[model samples]
Target: MKKNLIMSFVLSTLLVTVLSGCGAASKSTTGTADDTKAPAATTTTKSEKSTTLRIGYQKYGTVNFLKANGELDKALKEKGITIQWTEFPGGPQLLEAMNVGSIDVGHTGEAPPIFAQAAGTPLVYLGHEPASPASEAILIPEKSEIKSVAELKGKKVALNKGSNVHYLLVKQLEKAGLKYEDIQVVFLPPADARAAFEKGSVDAWVIWDPFFSAAETSAKAKILADGKDTVANHEFYLATRNYAENNKETVKIVLDQLAKVDTWSKDHPKELAETLSPQLGIDVPSLERAAKRRAYGIQPIDDALINEQQKIADTFFKLGLIPKEIKVKDAVLPATK
Candidate 1:
């Protein structure tokens, strides 16, 4: 399959990255690639010797808002660091870019990082936004007779593999007293999954916002179950271990600016959707609906959160989605004092 081949290429690229001891790419926000630029050596405390800070972001979340605000850019510029913004289709691909040293830090949901860490990608848990369990859900067609998660057994469900919604699907099934094998899972990206759901090729689709919000507004998809009782569905920010270790000051600057964005976003509820809609290509109403339930305030990774990540890792390994077991703590950076 084309998807399989693409993944194979990504894996091969990662192997070459690790083998060559090559540092991350210094690609600017433009399409240009700068493989010759390695990280600058840290000179002294608070110097943050790095000149360019590469970042990866998906269609949604903290970095996008932060970049748009330009406050982080101002702060980092004071420290002599500029940001390279690279967009990825999803968390897995973003982390793949991270593994290939394409970017330094990126944001993702709960499950992708577990898979990334399991594969031995040298990434560290940086920080997290507050949990928004209502952001993701198991959605059915507008008129489908299927009314509950239990009814989904034996039906085809579509979702992006190794995603936050993947675990949402799993936990929701268990709450319904069903096993992982109870349904047919079609692993597709958000766009393809949306198409499949619209065509009725799949009985239900598991997904997160703003896609979840878009579905409700556009297709009238019914929620069989949201993450509410099933999962935390926290959004996390991650960086390569090397990036975090050598450029701790730069990392702190990024998180600090994120905190500012969170405050402004929380205080301006209606504006959240209005501001993001243009970039996201979704209507303001849907973006508003999705943003309403999401909480703000980015916090450092803690043991309580680490335990939850561990549970996700254990569940994936049990389902044989991952080849081996992993420890969430192993990839975590200690909290900044």
Candidate 2:
């Protein structure tokens, strides 16, 4: 009877041990099932549709008109794409945002992208606005002695560095039979440059519209030389390489709308000024003068435009404005469809 009891106890212990082992295995399987479900939930969250199209733009360009019109939103809404506009003070800042991947598309003057490219920012030229040569100019106070670009020798010339106007000043100086070193170049953005010009701290202010128009009307400034006889200040629409390559269709939509707006602006200067004045905080007449001066021709990128851009890059590099040589063609997108 004692031996039978010992065998029974041993069997009971075996059963308990096996059951404990099976319990642990079951718990392990349950944990794995939980882990598998968690991944699926995460995947679903990540797979949710991304539907925002972010565009970077300056206050002075066609993108501003696009934002004000709301037509781009209407056009893209059907495709599950919504427009998000970011305003930048200038092209360099706009491209800076693009370089950091904060913006998908932007518009800038001819020089900003070159500077951005020299700094290793990956960009592609998507389209361009026809050169509005008269829109940008070198201005002198109405009563100042500086009559011509040649008279600017040894004078304080205020302008924004790395801006399209920078190249304009350089070319204007060369055209006036003066070298860059012959003048005192004071680098300032539009606001500060305008301030300095008003204060008479700078001899001449190199600027663009509606600032140019405002200066002419408000400050009684005279144009020493406009872009007419200088560099072609072709405004460029730019996109990140990744965005341009992946979203050609969306880009095409934007280009089409911009083309329409450009044409409309050309035909209706007073209307464009009326639409822009309240937003720009400038008077209607100044805005009207600016609108009329603008060419309002946005075109697709081509080899000719690329070559012209290369000249700008080369000029900046030669002048030691950009750190290194950059090829503009490296960033040219497939011809706008």
Candidate 3:
């Protein structure tokens, strides 16, 4: 009977050992399964890469107001994007930088884009400001007797070549029954033109404000014609095609901030002038006059707008300003909606 009991105890001890070993192996298998899930969790949620936005702006554009107010910096900070601002004298220079891929986006007058497109620059029109027809004009000496655009014939007219005012001069001369070849177009920048005007060197000056207002206030200047009867006088925002395609969301943010500033400026013209006076180096009254003449609404580029721009392009081509015929819509982006 003692031998029987000893055999039963050995069987029970072996059974316990086998059960414990099975339990440990099962636990090891479960741990291996858990280890396999960690990689998938890592794959599902990856870290986002950082980005940068480089913008080119002119001294007197809406982008300048955006920079001064710090709206763009605040809006883009959370997206891990940095803002780099560079200033140019005018839209042509700004778009020149854009063509070289140095600037991601910029603001320019309408005619600059037309010329840029003619030159085969791959730019995209992002948005535009409403037409401020009276914002630009053709000025003669206040005491001069050139009463009509007709009198500008055979006279030296000072203006920036390929500028928005260039279109104005073309259209106005046409309306006055004068051919472009009738007048000698003098290509000079605003400052040089101003000096020539003061010295009575150029018979007339075609320019925009606050420079226009400054000329009027500082000297005797008279407006022969304003854009009200000639052109839309629209301001455009342009981006390179590559950047627009890659950074649509960042571009949307930029447009949103500009819209906000546009609204604010329209509501508070006096304050806008006060803010811009120091930056533009013009007096408050002149800036105020300019602010009033400015169109403060932002609109997306549409097919109709592209058609209008195409007309400008064709006009420039016919006038021998651009090399060949080009389509404005080819350099345009879809609405940011």
Alpha-carbon local distance difference test for all models: 0.83, 0.79, 0.79
Mind giving the per-residue lDDT tens digits that candidate 3 earns over 8-66? 99999999875444212111111113221101001111233226676777757688789
Ranking by TM-score: 1, 2, 3
**Model 1, 1-337: lDDT tens per residue?**
9999999999999997674553342223522343344333232333345677878777768787887677887898888787777766678877776776677888999999999988888889989998899999999999999978999889999999888899999999999999999999999989899999999999999999889999999999999899997799999999888778888788888998899898888778568788888877889989888878888999878889999999999999999999999998999876531
How accurate locally is residue 196 in candidate 1, as Cα lDDT from 0 to 100? Answer: 96
Question: Best lDDT goes to which candidate?
Answer: 1
> What is the Cα-based lDDT of residue 49 in candidate 3?
29
TM-scores across all candidates? 0.86, 0.83, 0.83
Q: What is candidate 1's CA lDDT for residue 55?
A: 83
Once fitted onto the true fold, the runs of candidate 1 whose alpha carbons sit more than 4 angstroms away are: 1-48, 335-337
Candidate achieving higher lDDT, 2 or 3: 3
> Candidate 1: what lDDT?
0.83
Which ranking of candidates, highest lDDT first?
Answer: 1, 3, 2
